[model samples]
Target: MERDFYTFCTAMKTLDIGSAEGRGMSPQNYATIRLALAACYGKLSKGRVGSSLELTSEQEEHRERKGRHYCGLKEKGKRKDHERICIPGVAAAALSAVVFARMRHSSLEVLLCGLSLFDVLVLSSTLLIYPAMNACQNEPDPTNSRVCHFFWRSTLIAYPLSLIAQAGSVWTCVAITFDRFIAVFFPIKKRVWATPHTSTYIICGVAFFSVLFKLPAFFEITLNEYGQITPSSLRLDATYQLVYMTYMYLIFILLIPWTVIIVLNGIVIQKVREAYRTHKRLTQRNTRGRRDTDERKMTVMTIVMTGIFVLCNIPPAINNIIESYAPQYRDRYRHRIPLSTLLVCVNSASNILIYCWFNRQFRRSVFRLCSSAAYKRRASEYIRASKEASMSQTLKNKL
Candidate 1:
């Protein structure tokens, strides 16, 4: 069968070439069709020898180049990597942002603002760059315009915006932790930090500071002739790699912020424990139990969110630290970046779930929002039933 098919294709090729020339087809068009036919023939004659099976040096070189993959192009075994991560992350972030928008007036408004903002940033950046990222993962052609343009734009431009959003998210958590600490340890100052207005200011300040800090990243990235993103020529220097890259990630982004989060949350937990013990001793009644339950729920929510943030961020943070010192690891780290990004998106998106789980008020609000139309329909039905009953009674009285 293979031999027959090969002969058939060979015969078709000769006939087509001869016809192309006779039919007044341009040399360029004929050449293209010839190459296409050749490639098709190559597939059909994979195991056979002679003209079809023997690839030229140049052809072999092209094949080798196609096989050459960057880390971003790799998949998790046979599974798709980017779509699995980016799509879900974008969805979760969007849902969380929408859900949390209703709870803006709460004491935790500042944290919610930060979280929602981060979600929006993630949504935008992910959507803007998802095509490019997906293409880079799946397609080999670096010359793809959408891949080059969107990927470079996302990485070089939108990425820094995401960085600011991320920093704001971190600082927001830090602020919440600190607020909880103050509320527990120093009650008098709780009013100052935990207020909605104060949270707004803090959120704004975080945004401002993050923009200021992440500005350096914008200048450090550039696109090559093929539209692939690479570090700036200036960033090739040892000083930039050692000082700015290393310290920027290790000290400022990861170490200090993470340390502050851990310490503050730890204190908040300790204080919570003390309060629980005191509350238990003071009241054996169910009323106090309800309050205690509420407190416990909030504590659980905070812990879960903080835990997820830390866990999801660990890989990227470690890579940052390592890549800071050893520049060679940067390429290897790119392979894992999509996974890291997915983790962060999940973390950002899960906050709404945590809110619904932990806060009764939030749950009620969400329920009311979701079931508002149903509630109205029920009310209208009840009114109609009452009117019908009254009319029946009136007619019966008249009779």
Candidate 2:
């Protein structure tokens, strides 16, 4: 489809990811989009050999800001290979841990150990890696600029790793919801139908499906002929490869799952409130008292977790809307601007904090990990051998 000019400009001016937000793009005003992109996205249109080429859209606009990922544009120096590796490592680690946690087939109570480990790994990696990241500066070292160096060799690999991990989470959550629904609506067969064996099977099916769903993304990113890591420039004819993937991400993955989560969570919340109110009424009818704090805790937790899911998803959802319907806005804002890229990065990174705040089970697991027997033993050894540190320095003192 060709571009629409007016809608694009309107979308650009209003979006938070635009010039009005104090985002940086060099040469703040430009006569053309190409000039603005070179100034803002750190690409010099003047490279001698490996110069990055700019694409023009008849409807395209350029702005002076930070997040515009005018891909492949680089300042005249070599790609600063070492500067951006940290994001990928953190991604990989989180993904691996998530897979480990969802490996349960039976005996959930015992398997909860694995789940706890997985959650802790994901939470810790996601949170820690961000602050650890070095600012993306252009390094003269070509070797450091390699994609492998950017993710694994430089800092961590748990961030991109999270794309798959999130798919796993969505699958697991859907499975859990399905499990709850079956028990709630089919109470008579609860013990028989919702047995550990059945839950195990459900988990397995969801895991396989989630993995299959995410395979495309993993494959789409690869090392190109130039020894440079490049994201998929999906062929024009490969509808399923590029455009289809984009829509799938917008509709099935982010949009559909979020919609289901909201509706189901709304129902669950309504039921919980009704159950609580009914309990209070019946108690007054019989004994003149309501349930205590523990019941209230469950109520509060249900609301908290539900809110987390929605809050964690908002950015990417916004991105999808912009990418799908607001292309002209994307164009006019210009690749020279940085607002768009920052929003996308934020979308990618927010999940770390989500589990930390809402998933009580996850937080508790992290606490347990810190206080684990192995940790305690190692901590004691450190204390016994050291003269500068003491009893007050242990994690227990803080957590």
Candidate models: Cα lDDT each: 0.65, 0.45
- The runs of at least 3 residues in candidate 1 whose Cα sits more than 4 Å from the true structure, single-residue gaps closed, are 1-102, 224-228, 282-296, 328-333, 372-399
- Candidate 1, 326: how far from true, in Å? 2.6
Model 1 residue 12 lDDT?
44
RMSD of 1: 11.2
Each candidate: RMSD: 11.2, 12.3
lDDT of 1 at 319: 70
Per-residue lDDT of candidate 2, residues 232-278 (tens digit): 55422357644655777776677777777767667766766766776
For residue 37, give model 1's deviation from the true position in Å: 22
TM-score per candidate = 0.69, 0.53
